[model samples]
Each structure stands twice: as C-alpha cells, then as structure tokens.
Target chain A: MKVYNISFQIDPDLEFQWLEWMKNNFIPSLMSTKSFTENKFYQIKVNADQSPTYTLQLYCDNIELWQAYQELQANDHLKELQYTWGEKCYYFCTEMQIVN
Target chain B: MKVYNISFQIDPDLEFQWLEWMKNNFIPSLMSTKSFTENKFYQIKVNADQSPTYTLQLYCDNIELWQAYQELQANDHLKELQYTWGEKCYYFCTEMQIVN
Candidate 1:
C-alpha cells in the first residue's frame, strides 16, 4: 500500500474549526472516493513557531489510484481549503511506499 | 498514546544498508526497552533532490515514557547514528498527539 502523508501548519486559534471541518466534511468526502482505505490524523509537536502542525495520512492501494484522486478530487479540495482558511493554514504532502 | 515521528533524509545510495541496520538492530534495540508499543517505517515520496526521505513512527503509551526514553536511550542511539552515518543521513523528529 501507499500512504499520502500531508502535514498542515495551522493557526492554533482555528484548530477547533479546522478539526471539526475535517471530521464533518473533508475526511468523509475523501474516503467516499474509495481511493483511500484508511486515514489517521495526528497533531504534531515541532519546536518551531506557535503554529500547530497536523499530519493526515491516507492509505491507498496504489499510486495510480492516488494520482487519480489527486487529479479528480484533491485539486479542488485543496483550493477550497486555501480559499476558506486563507493564510491561516498551509500544508505540504508526501507520498510514501510501505516497505514492510 | 504519543507518536514520535522521525523523518530521515538519507542519501539514496545508503538506503539498503540503512534499512537493514534499522530493521535488524535499531528497531529491535529500541523495542527491547518496552517503551514503544509499536513502530512503522515508510519511505516518503517527494519531488526534491535524489535523497530519499523516510519516516519512522514510534508509539509510546505516554509522553512521560517517551521523555524517559529520550533521556536514557534515544540520546545514545541518535549519537551513534550521527557518528556512523555522518552527513549521509540527517533526520528531524516531531512528536504527535493522537486526538482520535
């Protein structure tokens, strides 16, 4: 399986709203695509700024399905997030192959 | 539980040896402490340089235990890694709180 790990640097004040939106809207929509088999969210601790870092790992069956999700759904979802959150949130994504 | 997420940027050439050492030596040694309940290693995909990025997630029952591990074992383990790998492998760590 493959994992799409996305880390978000979000304003601490908006964390509640972000988490609620993700739980009620974003995650369900993504999972509905059936491209991802499972997902996990973590609030990461970094010794940087006060901004909280969160990681969302989505497990996919293969790269092709992941790419398809990116092309068909991810772009719009990302755009929506940016539009709604403005500069309050920023993110980066990394795809990983499970070796063991 | 708390998750210690460590990401390593290693020269791709040394990946095989790194994986072997981690699987046979590092992980087992760390686990022997009984501090971490579980572990996972993933090879991350990024569009950066030729260097490969790997993330090792270690699950601890609590932050206190994690801190104790860092003080007693992690320091030495990290030192040994840097000593042996030098600039070939560099890593950064983030501790995460699982909310769900």
Candidate 2:
C-alpha cells in the first residue's frame, strides 16, 4: 500500500480555521475522488515551529492511483490552499510504503 | 486515540539488519506490554539522507498508557537499540493525536 502524507505547520491563531477547512473541504474533497481508500488527520504533539503541526494521511492501493490524484485533483486543490492560507499554513508532502 | 511514532534513518548497508531487529525484537517485545492496541511500520519513500527512512507507529487509547510504556519498557528498548546500532541507525520520536 502507498500512504501519502501532508505535514503542515500552522500559526496558532489559524488552527481552528485551517482545521475546519481540512475536515470540511480538503479531506472530503480528496476522498470523494475515490483515489484513496482511507484518510486520517493527526496533530503532532510538538511545537517545534512554535505553531501547531499536523500530518494528514491518505492511503491508496498503489503509486498509479496516487499519481493520477496529483495530476488531476491535488494540484489545483493544493494551489488553492496555498493561495488562501498563504504562510499562515504551510506544508510538505511525503509518500510512504507499508513494508512490515 | 494517541499514536506514538519513531522515525528512523538507517544507513543503507544496515537496512536489512535493522529491519530484522525491529521486527523480531523491538516491536514484538513492546507490543507484549499490552500498552498499545495496534502497530504499523512504514518506509518513507524518500532518500533524503541517501538512506532508508521509516516510521514505526504504535496506537493506544490515551497518554497514561503511553507514559507507563515509556517508564517500564521504552526506555530500556530504546537504550538497547542505541547500544546495538549506534550511529548506523538513528531515530527521533513524535506523539500525535487523532483530531478528526
């Protein structure tokens, strides 16, 4: 299985807004595409950036499905997030494989 | 629920050995404590340090059990790991809360 992760760091003041957007819009919109079978939102219990940190996880069957997601949907959605949130919420993406 | 993660970076030459020790020794021993309800191992698909990176996750219901684990088991296991692998394998810890 392939797991796609978006590790985000958000200003403390924007946590509530960013979280609502993630739950109501970001996650739901991505899951609706059927490219991913499961998704979860996690708040990292650290303040390394002096802000709230989180990692949104998306699980899919293979890289092909993930690539399709990036090409067709994720690009625009991510772009919009950047434009809307600006530096208040920034993130980096990662993909992982379940090896054991 | 709470998720405890150990993100490890291992020298490529030590990958196989480290994987074996983690699977056969560390993970099983820790799970025997009944502190966590579930566990998963993920290999991050990035050669960020020219080596393999992995995240080992253990899920529990709350922080109390996790703390108990840290007190009774994790300290010893972690120390053992450091003693055994030294610089060949290094890791950092993170705890997370499932917010949605």
Candidate 3:
C-alpha cells in the first residue's frame, strides 16, 4: 500500500476546531471518495513552536489511486481548509510506498 | 502508542545494501531490544533528487520506552551506520503520538 502523509502546523487557538473538522467532516468526505482504504491521525511529540503539529495518513492500494485523489479531489479539500482556517494552519505532504 | 519515524536520504548506488542491512541487521537488533512493538519501512513516492528517500517507523507503547531505546542503543547503531556508509546515508527523526 501507498500512504499519503500530510503534516500540518496549526495555531493553538484553532486546535480543537481543526481536530473536530478533521474527525467529523473532512475524514468522512475523504472516506466517501473510496480512494483511501485506511486513515490515521497523529500529533507530533516534539514541536518548537507554540502551535501544534499533526499528521494525517491516508493509505491507498497504489500510486494511481493516490494520484487520482490528488488530481481530482485534493484541491477542493485544500481550498475548504484554506478558506476556513486561512493562516491558522499550514501543511506539507509526502507519499510513501510500504516496503516491509 | 507512539511512533518514532526516521526518514533517510541515501545514495541510490547504496540503496540495496542499505535495505539489506536494515532488514538483516538493524531491524533485527532493534526488535531484539524488546523496546519496540513493531516497525515498518517505506520509500517516499516523490523525489526531485537522484537519491532515494526512505522512512523507518518504530512503534512502542509509550514515550519512556522510546526514550530508553534512544538513550541506551540509538547512538551505537547510528555510529555503526555512519561508519559503514558515512556520507552516503543521512537521516532525520520525528516522534508522533497516535491520535486516531
């Protein structure tokens, strides 16, 4: 499986909203897309900033599916996040192929 | 549970040796320590450079166990890797707490 990992740095004031939106709305919509087989969320143990860092991992069967999600659905979700949170949150993404 | 994620950028020429060493020696020794419950390896899907980027994630029950592993055995293994590969391999690490 291939994992699409998105790590975010979020303003402390918006942490609860971010978590709620991810758990209730974002993830559910992502699941509805049927591209991801599994998903996980994580909080980074070390962060220098006052803000919090989080990671969201979405696992898919192959690169093609992940690519499809990126091309077709990523922008909308990204836009939604940007519109809602603006500068309160920012993120970077990485994709990994499981070898073990 | 907690995940200790190590990401590496290794010279492509030494990729096979790195993988073999990780599978044969490093991971085995890590598991033998009884500090980690599980581990996984992955190759990042996107790269602008010629080198291959990989991630190794070790899971443990808590921060204390991970700290124990880090304080007790990490440097020795790190030294062995550096001694063997030198500048050909370099890495960064992050720790994350499972939130969902």
Best by lDDT: 2
List the pairs of residues colliding in candidate 2.
none
| Model 2 agreement with the true structure over B1-100: per-residue lDDT tens digits | 9998999999899899899999999888878899999998999987556689999989999678888998878878789889999999989999899996
Q: Per-residue lDDT for A28-62 in model 1, tens only?
A: 87788899989988888777666888888899987
What residue pairs clash in candidate 1, if any at all? none
The alpha-carbon deviation from the true structure for residue A56 of candidate 2, after best TM-score superposition, in angstroms, is: 0.3
Backbone clash total for model 3 is: 0
Question: Model 1, A48: alpha-carbon shift in Å?
Answer: 7.3
> What tens-digit string does per-residue lDDT give for candidate 2 at A12-98?
998999899999988888888899999989999876567899999999997788889988888887897898899999899998889
Worst 10 residues of 3 chain B by lDDT: B44-53
Candidate 2 chain A — worst ten consecutive residues by lDDT sum? A43-52
Q: For model 2, what is the C-alpha lDDT against the true structure?
A: 0.89
Q: lDDT tens string, model 3, A19-86?
A: 99989997788878889999889998765655799999888986787788899998898788788888
- lDDT of every model, 2 decimals: 0.84, 0.89, 0.86
**B68 in model 1: Cα distance from truth in Å?**
2.3
Question: Residue-wise lDDT of candidate 1 within B1-100, one digit each (tens)?
Answer: 7898778988888889998988898778878888899998888877766688888889988778888998888888788788878999999877888767
Model 1 chain B worst lDDT window (10 residues): B44-53
Off by over 4 Å in 1: A62-64
> If scored against the real structure, what TM-score would every candidate get?
0.90, 0.94, 0.90
- TM match of model 1 to true structure: 0.90
Question: Predictions ranked by DockQ, top down?
Answer: 2, 3, 1
